[model samples]
Target: MAITTFPMIEKCTSIDRENDIVVTDLDGTLLRGRNSFAYFALVAFDVDGVLRLLFLLLASPIAGILYYFISESAGIQVIVFATFVGMKVFDIESAARNVLPKFYSEDLHPESWRVFSSCGKTCVLTATPRIMVEPFLKDYLGTDIVLGTEIETYKGRATGFVRPPGVLVGKNKVDTLTSTFGDTQPDIGLGDRDTDIPFMTLCKEGYFVPSNLKVNAVSTKVLPKPIVFHDGRFIKKLTPLVSLLIILWIPLGFLLACVRLSVMSFLPIPLQYYAFLATGIRLIINGIPPLHIKKSKGLLFVCCHKTILDNIFLSVALDRPVPVVTYSTSRFLNIFSPIKTITLTRDRAFDASMIKKLLKQRDLTIFPEGTTSRGQFLLRFSSLFAEITNEIVPVAMETKMSMFHGTTTRGWKWMDPFFFLMNPRPTYEITFLNKLSYEFTCKSGKSSHEVANYVQKVIAETLSYECTTFTRKDKYMALDTIVKNP
Candidate 1:
């Protein structure tokens, strides 16, 4: 009954489709090689899949070790069903409709569809849950019979348990099949793993799908590396030191900035000791290593904004208290903040006059992205800043955190800095590019918008991120709509 070779079917095979029943494994056989459970979690749950996968990985070892003491069937049932504990049936159905088509197009076996179409009665039987596979089978593939693990549900949510005849693996699979179709056997069975042999043995013919036929799961490829955290006891011990740094450096940094502004009123070099101290505090708390490629005065620094923390890190990386030009909405807030900034009104003439005054004092920094992002991509650069100066320095900035993200479309601007400080450990990386002068802009006849786009592209490429035309206003509007609907 065992057919080890994958027979090449150039056209429709000579098998009798009118009377014979076809049984196939969904995961490794009909679907290209991938973990069916993992794929289901990712396609259905999105970001939540990371946590689910991590939980499974961590729990699996413990479950395996406990198997020697407990029944192996119980351990498998507990481990497999735990993932669906709180999920709603309706949500799973909706997600299946959205994700299954893409999955099928990308990972379905090249020849399985033809075999499926020609079968008289086709059945998908796998260790995967019946609820998860039935929709795709009945709606898309036009198959009625699906024999798989059954998840117990209460009301609308999963009860984190499987019904009797749990996890169709090994002998349990044979028993379940025998109970369902007594005195009958499949005409053909296809499977990819040794575990599938039990049910496949009952078929008149069996085909072993090679492991190579399985495609790599794209979700696993793009999955982020797991975050390891300091032990709670160790974090507790460092809490006092962290508190001391925040309490001492914040006010000290502000006072130092004020003194530098007062000294700049009369002297040439603005005292940047406060900026250095603030950077030190940030480094100590977050343990971010600042790498400076270029540090020079009087160069305009164009950067991507992720959070208010970007200003502090850039000042440290550049080794200067760079005066920032910000949108006028946060003018009053900046007055009370530690950093020195010039708030720009929407009026072009007013902004031009302020920029002229600021440039005379020292190096100026502007976030042409205009709004804070999640550090995954760059927003469209406003051309207004590029027109202000010819000696432009493009600075690419990125921030990483294991726990919290300090980004908002509709939150108090002043609170963003506090969010960074509150995070247990946040890292910021800044890369300074070669200063873009008039020569770079001269190619497009010194078009400010073109120059701005050029700089934006440089930063986006350096950070390995995509560029978008989304703005601060668009972000807030989207957020507002989500809140209203949600």
Candidate 2:
């Protein structure tokens, strides 16, 4: 194949990419952007709340003027200051690792990515903070090297200052590229703006990616690793305007959530469904239990956790409160006063005795996943549910929120229900799968783990979710390093 040299990336014909070294700019080059302010706003809001977000928005005007006229580095410095000053290093790192990937993956530039991803050794040179962009670039895009402006830190907190040599822009990017690759020039370079041209010239072949709104981004499925898990409070990217709207909505949203919770707490189970719709909540239920439900004295309803309110809604669906088994705490979170609670302290023998006693008298529920997930994927199930009962029914639960997420690893766990209800229209869909047949039950001579995995697979297939070996302990340990040796 022959290569056709063209001024813009749109005119490129072909290239032998297997052995070529590629260097690229981010933001406008590798991703679509008005600029990186939206990402900054997202990080600020997620890590520190609306006050931090407002600071960044207020500073944007000054930054914009400096960027267009005075200096790009100066403008970015202001953004770095407003968003990161006085914040813990771990919080920013956590947001970068967990929150930014989904948004960044959605904005990939089609033309730039096709050429950038095909090369042997790929490097991304950007003005965005290295800590902020490295995880997405390495994990999702498979970049080999990342060179970006380095932030200054003191006592494990951001000082809102950059290290000496300052932001990587103009000539700094060229210098960084040469230092990393040494004497051998890169085979190709891709960039989107005039500032990027300095670094692009260092490569043998350079392509310009002009701003193109008509082009669609590549699908997330094409990434090197599928993003199975992510954490954040906001449901969408927080632009300056969007951030403002959220701040204004919170007071009214809080009042509305209180009304919704009150309805669930005081109203009859039959009337709760109608009352939810009247107050802007949407509940979609599917699949009644097998007819064998009539004979149920000890039905074990197992599900992947979605929220604290899950059992409350499960109770509503069953027309009575269901005591939920929890390992974390003894408290059962239910709106109805009649709802009962069972706390398992992770002692197999004691919990087994307690659970066996209840099964003889009534039907109860268990979140075999052990922790709440966003519902796009099912975490590994605990085999204890399978071992404890022969009467297990898998239930699939999913929630959709327009404004805020109801679950978080960092924020207040108790406030999850309030945050969920605060959404403009919060929706939950509950699907009950068929009961485990005698052949698949533990009573049928299968191992407990085998039975649990089967239940996970069934619920995952029903919800169109990918099943993972990750558990609640793995989740906390990954994010917070809370469980050091787990």
Candidate 3:
């Protein structure tokens, strides 16, 4: 059958909001990418580590040749095999839920979104696996259905192979669409490349998305909600070259981490800043100058936690060693920590009494959020700090690492500080706000929870972050729900 060429995607305006059924391709049409290698690298690293990412990088040349020179299906299969093979099914789905949406929500194509978002009934057809792209499409994009390639899994792991209709490219996509929709053809179809062309032809109307590099990403305000939390150790978008650099630099990075920790252990507080500067670690301190506070009960510094090093960076800002009450850090971290650390047992009364006693000796720091947050967000604050002392200083912290993040809930906790120090020039910004008013204090007849929420709000506003009631337990619960429900 001979068919005529359709108009370009720019013509796909005036979409019906009530009843139009739009079937759009994923990678290039919906997302601004010629391929999905970056996303594959993300899943690879998120699931295993740099070693798994290195494995995928080593195989990309093979995948590239198969995809560009030969069949797209064969190319996608090779890439899929490298990324998914031997990985636990639970891990893949977990990344799909927690990690992928944040990236996917950022990569939406403007023109495709203009048409795709208008329709009430929408379907995303992609060569990527269904489990991977489905959560983002259905939950974030409001798609009614998502048809993607099925990965073959055995027992509880991916077998690195696609199920029967294989890699959903070219003719396979058309067949799948036909099987799913039958005689009732979709009203609008959007696609990018030649493979997408086949499936687009099956729709009543087809539109082409050209490879244009000038297109800007749609504003993030269009999203249902901002990404408050995300999982992964990567500090930047992973490319093949970046992955190679990480694999090559791990040995030196590890050694660097050790040297930094060693210096922090013995170096005097004032000289530590210069020492860090010499080692290519940056600590950017802004806001008002630190006030001199001498009290029997030391000043309580409240913070929204970003990483394990929050207390360390907070002390750096004040140019003095401050004792901290920790939550889930290993004994190794506590033993070798430069300053004092007292582990909390989560017992409200016992922990409160411990912190109160510790504060009386000298200046003490506390991260009331309990756990670290990866983005510009503050978890619910524990109010015990407010009740202890009215002399409180709220500190807002932001960390930028080009290589690796310092915090992880799923991996080894002790290695977190090491990963943070291993970066080429990790940047930390500390913003100190004025001390809290006595009127908002527990001594003013206000409840402890009220003080906690007030402090959380001040820090959130200072950082321009939205407040979430989610605590550390809420984070783990969300991750657990992914495996159980998926």
Best candidate (score: TM-score): 3
In order of listing, the candidates' clash counts read 1, 0, 0
lDDT of each: 0.60, 0.84, 0.81
Clashing pairs in 3: none
Per-residue lDDT of candidate 1, residues 141-259 (tens digit): 67758888888889998777888878777687788878877998887777776667888889887777665553443332221221110001011111223334433444554554344
lDDT order, best first, reads 2, 3, 1
Q: Candidate 1 has which clashing residue pairs, if any?
A: 33-214
Worst 10 residues of 3 by lDDT: 477-486
Which candidate would rank higher by lDDT, 1 or 3?
3
Off by over 4 Å in 1: 1-62, 65-76, 80-158, 162-191, 195-299, 305-308, 323-362, 370-379, 398-429, 439-446, 460-486
Q: Give the TM-score ranking, best first.
A: 3, 2, 1
RMSD of 3: 2.9
Report each candidate's C-alpha RMSD, comma-separated, in the order given: 11.8, 3.3, 2.9
Candidate 2 weakest lDDT stretch, 10 residues: 329-338
